[model samples]
Target chain A: MNKFTEDDLKKELETKEYEYGFYTDIEADKFPIGLNEDVVIAISRKKNEPEWMTEWRLEAFKVWKEMKEPEWANVRYEKPKFQEISYYSAPIQKPKLDSLDQVDPELLKTFEKLGISIDEQKRLSNVAVDIVIDSVSVATTFKKTLNEKGIIFCPISEAIQEHPELVRKHLGTIVPTTDNFYAALNSAVFSDGSFCYIPKGVTCPMELSTYFRINEGGTGQFERTLVIADEGSFVSYLEGCTAPARDENQLHAAVVELIALDNAEIKYSTVQNWFPGDKEGKGGVFNFVTKRGLCEKNAKISWTQVETGSAVTWKYPSCVLKGDNSVGEFYSIAVTNNFQQADTGTKMIHLGKNTKSTIISKGVSAGKSQNSYRGLVQIGPRAHNARNFSQCDSLLMGDQCGAHTFPYIEVKNKSAQIEHEATTSKIGEDQLFYCNQRGIDTEKAIALIVNGFSKEVLNKLPMEFAVEAQKLLEISLEGSVG
Target chain B: MLQVKNLHASINDKEILKGINLEIKAGEVHAIMGPNGSGKSTLSAVIAGKEEYEVTEGSVLLNNEDLEDFAPEERAHKGIFLSFQYPIEIPGVTVTNFIKTAINSTRKAKGLEDLPAKEMLKLIREKADLLEIDRKFLSRSLNEGFSGGEKKRNEIFQMAMLEPKLAILDETDSGLDIDALKVVANGVNKLKSKDNAVLVITHYQRLLDYIVPDFVHVLHNGKIVKSGGKELALELEEKGYDWLK
Candidate 1:
């Protein structure tokens, strides 16, 4: 029998390539490098936005130029050149297609390879997908059901064209342009993203999802997503992203805003799997995103995310609980492997009486990656009898990896209650030997242990995403269990 | 069923099992008692193919085949089960799920389909009842926050579930209470058959009273110095291992 030593496993892990590294060859209508007032005007004009929307973009642009890139996040990388990045890029011949037959065959093939064809999704899973490739919203399925239920689901650009009043009312409400550096940049030059609104006292029938793919190199993807749940309504939204493998570092800065009106609820989920450079950490994506939600009286908002890719990630999805008896929840599982760095968590703000929040964050670091959980729980002075529970756990695979947790809790109310628990653990050899002595191989043992570690956060995911996330965790931690 | 001929094992350049010879046939139960640092646990770990222990000049054979290059899991698939003295606690993995994985993994190695869920649950329930374990304990995380006695019983529970051809109990009765010891001993006894063998490594003669061994060996200084019948256990209990040493 041939002996496979631990050194061989290490070598195998060092050579593992990104799974979704294939690129689409197509012509694109792209903007010239560098950004100015004219570039912002051109982007607004290209989208055929109304005058008020154009002015909003200009205002965001003016503030973005003055706002410096925030360095507070615990991630180190070469800062991307804003001037060298194309502000907007869209695949040509991707205009409004009434049916799949009119769509480009290559685009259809890409979606099929992505395993999320609109037809298959509709017939099998009933998930309506709005796909954005290189900043353009190409195809959105299941509109008839949305229309029947009095729901508004489409691209933000289309929403600006069709429902200007609604867009204007909620575009920059939750995550305003001045919220952060990335939010300002995204608001100014965002190409396109999904926009959804549930009517009052109604529940959206199916899962509304968006798949963002960065196909064009040298183009920064800045997408903006907004969701609004009317009074006594409910909706669940999902967002997933991936980019092709490239030698040059790519940038993805997106802003997402969600609103839950009185007596309404919103559940938002994200599975981010960008191309996280090669084993040597040569070239990958720099992901900076701003996502936040606002809850009205007697409303609820929940955010669940599984982050497994990106060379560097700095994101904090938060919820502002402004309603009495409101609830906020943030459940996240961030897996970093092979030179990946992620500083991701959430914030829950309590401003109303009897509000509650729960935060469960699990981070897994393998190889030479660094994974950190940074969270904040704030209780305002008026928020009497507020409660918050937070648990942050980190699982380290190798000695070369690092995991950190920085939790900030600020309570101004005397009646507020808070609880926080944290634990750090490694995949000890004793545990592996135990599993192996029971007939499980090393790879399967790692998978089992990882699944066990992230069960809490994985259980919060929808059925489809839970399975996918489990597989992703196993893939990310391969061979590093030594 | 098992053989260890001239087995010399060491960890970190220090030889623990200097040179040892052992052989056991089917349907036989052998107990090896020794004082502290007598290489009892090292022998079991080497048999189970733990990566830490290096067998300098040795061969552990299961049946007539040489188990030289098999990984720990392969050794397990070859029917070598080690009831660890300290079983690891893996949080969030339920006891039933852990056993199911272990069994299916072994089956897969043997080119067999996974045990069906219904049958798996049935076997698990039967084994749990045999070990006198509560149903609620089956759903809890494997050994997480479990009492010491519960942990040991859980180890025996796993041994019963796997039903290996050769089971090595490594100090499984150290922390176990009297009742848990009886349950564990009963489980091992029920699992024993004409096709299987057992190796019990303990420091005391208490557990042997419940699960009587056919042979008792005294190990001293990484070597089995004396080999005798079951009466040697009672004699050693009254006298001590100092005479053998």
Candidate 2:
């Protein structure tokens, strides 16, 4: 309203620095740079993993050695040198604290800067958090409250020691060690991630969350997460990540597997805001992840993600419906600005009768970045009366950016019903003028328009997450247009 | 309250409003009638500070202040409003929210706090009643899937809310039936006062019958060729625009 000219908006955008760009000076116990049999064994040994787990990682390492990096995504970047990445890195002194006051001050300050203060979150949102810093879980809050409900919530390493049966039963069942290139690599060297289990017929009273931070400079975060919802149970899990700005691209390859048995439901949400380097595309995180879930009879699985960071992102959180009357849903909003590139979407596989799936994806591309939504929906031969609906919309800020959609639908059953709709549009000058005439400046106008364009997916997020995601979208597109 | 002197404007090097001159005082309703390509909308756009048009030579002033350097929004904050002929459809933003943003933004420009929600809702309800608008219509996305008549009514509804010192209705009666035209004209009439003015640009004289402009001017080839009292509109209505050619 104070006459914010296009130049002013552009300048404001250029000055928008990454909020989570600070680095902590904690000493790291990191493995040597490079990926080999020795590195994998070292990571497994450092975790003090069991013999069977060690053997499983060795098998994954062998498969990863022979696999090739996927080149099918609609993105262009220099291939990451896997051999140059530190396979594992963690804080030298791990904190086994029972309360927030006992945690390290520096780590707590980092969380405060990221707006995930343990005390604040616990008092306000009632969300239990598992804080992971540099491939290790530092402190998990509200563990007692969760334990009272027969819920097992802790780091993966702790789970392996305390609840080995649950860890081993569903670790690689949905996403096996040989699923893909990144999954294989992550399976071989995953240092630490969150593990959640909900007992039979018990609904988790609070939202469970994991905050992942990559503090070390040259380390690659290979984290694996497993969530299991027993029969007639329900759980909602969310994860968030951020890293410091680096000159050399960092690697983040993660694997997450979810299992929901009969009459169970699981909702998984992610808000990823890793450092996306500088304006010239100098350095950022290269996030390549594989997340998938399995649904049994009358079970439901929903994946909602707001991806706004990473220099280059390649992920497809998918669902496999193997039981009758199962349902799968995906709602995503992927934003790319400056030199960032994102190729993220979902895959829904219908293998049983009366299966249903819905996919709503919104891609926003600004500056010179590229954003693509590549998804697949398949109905098998025995999937009688299956249904699938997909809507993909792209909003472009300037002429230099690009938004593309690739939807693959295959139906072997003649009774299946599938519908797909896609539209590509730019923020029109007329729209801007309309807002301008109404006394709204260009900056606020862009934010309003972009939020409106992404309302469908943003509405799918939780209340607090929706607010954060909206701010993230505004930040990502700042200075993207003049 | 508004003045346009020797207004020469063009877009993409093609001259549109060539040497147009106009003036409107407070408590007056003036209508500008023009044939196709006569630059009626161009005159309104140039006066509203649209950036696409290059002002070759001339000046537009509001309350004796030159408006050349003001952006469209700045002009709005300074009490100038243009009711667009085709309002943009912003999906997922309710009409109520859009208007709230506009009002709050203007208030912010004036260094004032946002209007209280209770007062804002009361004003909205009062204006909706004046325009005979349904309460449900205010909650729908702005102009998305709206009928043409509904869009015009919404524009006037906004004018009622903003209460600008100078309002330019560009082709407000183009796509409305007689009843819709009467409703819009009545709403505009209700908002008129001794301290503000209205400049109506239209191709038809039907709207003038309801609002009854004090003066009617014929714009031809980017110039006002004739000016007269309200009787001029009747004459133009009797004879087509070809008579002027």
Candidate 3:
């Protein structure tokens, strides 16, 4: 204590304070905190889902009841009390109007903050948006254009209603309902998420994005996102998430499954900016998500993510190479600052002969935050000639922060080839001095270095989301570096 | 425009520069020649405000202001530039973006307005031509996959862009052919003006043939042992640093 100065105490206090800690005010319907069979039935019935869908939900609930929470992720937190969370929270019913003004004002305001409101763009050019507020889809834009191209882009609820066969065929095929704890929960209680289906031999004309905003407190968001690209089809989807600043930690358990058939390609990206808890680690989001993709013969699937928010993050967007000559790629940049802890990466399972996968991950930690990259590449016994390359790099700014990399590679086939490289180093004073001598201040210099570090992953993101991600990265590392 | 009075600097508890005194007026080109263990680079690094080097004693004045209190970036805004001996390779960041950001940042620090994209593009193109740097190099990441000569040229291009009041070339001629050295020298000469100063730090005087210096000083054992006119560099080139030792 004698050696500790006032500056040290102030620094400790500053590390605990959360920058984005302002809550959004709204009133709406919310279910009692907790999960049970009745709650599952209530969620399905409230959405007016078909009887078979309701039965499916019940079956998943039954399976979920028999399973235990997964303990494999390198994240530890107070397990969210599932029974104390409200899975259903929506605005008052309104007419299904065709224009933006017909939507609820609260939902509109949320989208406004997200920078993707329909009112912001009179004629949406290449961007199509689906707004998911709380546990339900509020609205989707550019419906006519997607319909013209014979591409189905809508909410999963709507997909269940209009394209039930497509949903039934592909849903849970890649990631089963009981694959993991969060996935199992999402399987039984997911409220709403975006769904896209590209017809065979057709290339989607524009990028599709889903913006998710968690508005209600003490409510867990279980979003189920599914994408299906048929033979010779191509589609790119962007998913972004945010929650109003609050003191009560919220739970977000999402399940996303992507399937690319022969000669089809799919690119899925996420810019996760969930509200991490304030200093003292109070009131943030515990984000546990299961995102996986399946590439059929000659198919390609790529996943890119920029994860910055969340008090604790546990996710690994993965791929299953099932078809011969299929390709899988993952590029990710995860930044954690100020009492934030994130353990994220991807898994690539090569099952078809001659399949390949590549992964590049960059992690940055500052301000008492802990960031890690946990990835796995598995080559199946039958997958001869399988190939994989992985690179994981970590950048540390201050002594208080920690950066880690853990990669697991398993090769069963004698002909398979796998290579992995990882390095962890601090942003040396020399590097900072170099930038500073160029007239960039300490803060701006750190941002430049970080952006340069994540450029590969950021470049894979959609233009709109990439810009937002860049801004988020800058804000997250504000006064922590240099 | 630069003054160091009995400046003492050290790294890791070991003193590298001891009781060094130097002065440079505007429009003067000063060359510091030294052997491997000499502190020529240490002087440039300390003046550039590298954090690794601690100024244990004495003071540095740039145009009559206390230089110790300024940050590295503030010193840069005061028109000080160091052409790194080995340019860092920043992957994935284009040279255009890096230089533009650096230029605009300096401008902003000086309370100047931001440069428009079109204006910056035009300016960069003009400077690239002046330095004989290929336009494609501007689009690539800074020093990424560049050859030895290309890296040196890139450093010169950056020096041309910054147009600093004091330019410190730390061994800028160490890894260049005769032709490349001439091109770099030409670039430096074009950037020279009556209001700015240039400090050439190198062990070899080969670079002096291209950009003749106004003064040459011999640094040995962390101190300047000899000083003379331009002919001094030619003399050192002929006799080698062994004579100074």
Candidate 4:
């Protein structure tokens, strides 16, 4: 750095592009463009779903047709053309493989490039991975170990056939199909995702993870994930996502439901890194997700997410505390850069006596992006002594970028105690100079500062994913400073 | 080993430090004193390569190499350290983590491997003990909610860790009780060596009583109008800048 090398000799890029920009050209089984009742029925029928499941899809499709895309979020973008997007696109299927070696080499390479090698993950870590590419879950590792303890973990499509009673009982119960436009859409046409059922008194021994990749262009990925933890059981789930670079914006609508039964606990985390498009913002992913968890008496559910991508993001991972003494927690760090827009936060509904919830959200905006934290905390009637603490912090990297907060609190019970704190700040030039004077480069200094700003939330992630989340924060803000 | 030759600088096209010429060899301590707005801080910032001040004329050399093209961080890698008058707050970065990063970054810039964690721990323990900093204080967020004295003490702690060839302390004694100032000055004194020099910029002579400068230069307006032995600071302390003017 002291040598003052010429531009040609400077090895680093002046500005970084999305690292996961390469597209995989594997042959896929793509349906023709458009969505209708037939497409919903076809998606269910193609999975060889039961008659009741197909009926369920038809009902959701009817609900979706009547619902409209809500525009209450703080963002501006053109409406997506529903008729131009293919509802389902899956990698070309080979016969059931006994091991990952038999899986398509191209599919394996796609995961490899994303740094999630299925074979390595199986051997090295105690993390059970469900690899979902495009619209299908290709592999589920550590199934036998989980099955030995009466736990059921597999693809939702397979769950409908093999564990029909469990699927039938829990599906659409937490997140009803008529929840919203995107939820109804996801329910009607979700091709494939992961499903887990933890038996009573059984704690999952390994971290259950799902890696999602959208490789096929012009196709919408609607995935549904459901986790049911029985009484006194515990489970931790992690989700990660990425998409190939494309000029035409793609749509991603996913629904995740968690049912933590009495005395059970569930920790859910997501690292979302969909393409945020080129600097001029011509194309990227529109990530609209409905994620909520239901907690029974004495149950607990915690949702943590690090979102650094998606040109437009509208997500709120919420918790409904229907049982007394239940606990809810939402810790998030959302970073938006280069024309990206995000309106993401969490909701905590306290309906039971002594229910407690905590919300810590951090938003970092760089370039021309807009980031907002919109959250709600509701204390229902008869919920005596319900307590909630929420902190919303926003950090702006440049003058052009923006950070906003919208917090809604409703308390019907007089005994409810809710404390909320919010602050907006810009990265000070003195702070950067102080770091530079210490020999840390500006890029690394920004990362350090951001990590420090987001430490409270990052600490909630699993150790392995925490490292990746920190790196993603750095990459998302690279070249944002001069 | 440090040379600032006829330096002229400005901020927002307004001139500060119209002309400053100073030099310090190894094993020397230099103090620049003046009243308010005398450009003592501007000189320190210019030496540290802060972007705000545009150096209009003259050159600063460290070990015979001109430092015009080097960035603030590059200048840091070339052994220039500036302790700010007001330290910035990083809410969640602990002092231990910040110092480790600073040391490792300097090492990395020199094409050296990161110091092993064990070595880093030992160094941190030694420096913290020398500075009379409690172990628990190292774990708190850097400068967040810290008292003024704690902030200045932490700056000296960082200087001890970096061990720069030339350390510039800008108004290091602005807010300090006798006990805390002694701890800070003791820390700085313990780190001074034959291979490095110190530049202390202060408006008051209270700190110089402890730091004991070898040379004192009186600054008026943006220029250093008088230079003399360490007695110059004592004389100005009694007579004030009005006498010099």
Q: Candidate 3 has which clashing residue pairs, if any?
A: A16-A279, A33-A83, A33-A84, A34-A83, A34-A84, A34-A85, A35-A83, A247-A283
Query: Clashing residue pairs, candidate 2?
Result: A13-A479
Report, to 2 decimal places, the DockQ of model 2.
0.52
Candidate 4 clashes between residue pairs 3 or more apart in a chain or in different chains: none
- B88 in model 4: Cα distance from truth in Å? 1.0
- For model 2, how does the per-residue alpha-carbon lDDT over A1-482 read when each residue is reduced to its tens digit? 21222223334455478877889888788788888898888888888888888888999999988999999999888998888988888887645777777777888888888888888898888999998999999888898999899999999998988888888878888888888899999999999999999999999998899989899999999899999999999999988888888788998999999999999999999999998878998899999999999999999999999999999999999999998999999999999999999999999999989999999999999999999999999999999999999999999988999999999999899999999999888999888888888888787788878888888888887777777777777777777778
Worst ten in a row by lDDT for model 4 chain A? A1-10
DockQ of all candidates, in order? 0.56, 0.52, 0.40, 0.59
How do the candidates score on chain B by TM-score?
0.98, 0.98, 0.98, 0.99
Candidate 3 residue B131 Cα shift, in angstroms, is: 1.9
lDDT of each: 0.90, 0.90, 0.85, 0.91
Which structure among the candidates has the greatest TM-score?
4
Candidate 4 residues A1-482, lDDT tens each?
11111121122224377878898878989999998989988888889999999999999999999999999999999989998999999888774666887788888888888888887787776789988899788887888899899888888888898999999999999889999999999999999998999999999998999999789989999999999999999999999998988999999999999999999999999999999988898899999999999999999999999999899999999999999999999999999998999999999999999999999999999999999999999999978999999999999998999999999999999999999999998899989999999998888788889999999999999887887787778778887886
**Native A-B interface contacts kept, per candidate:** 0.82, 0.65, 0.68, 0.82
Q: Write the per-residue lDDT of candidate 1 for residues B214-237, one digit (tens) a residue.
A: 999999999999999999999999
> Across the candidates, what are chain A's individual TM-scores?
0.96, 0.96, 0.93, 0.96
> What TM-score does candidate 3 get on C-alpha atoms?
0.92
Which residue window of length 10 is worst by lDDT in model 2 chain B? Answer: B92-101
Query: Where does candidate 4 chain B have its weakest 10-residue lDDT segment?
Result: B108-117
The digit string of per-residue lDDT tens for model 3 on B38-100 reads: 998899999999888999998889999989988899999999999999888776677887888
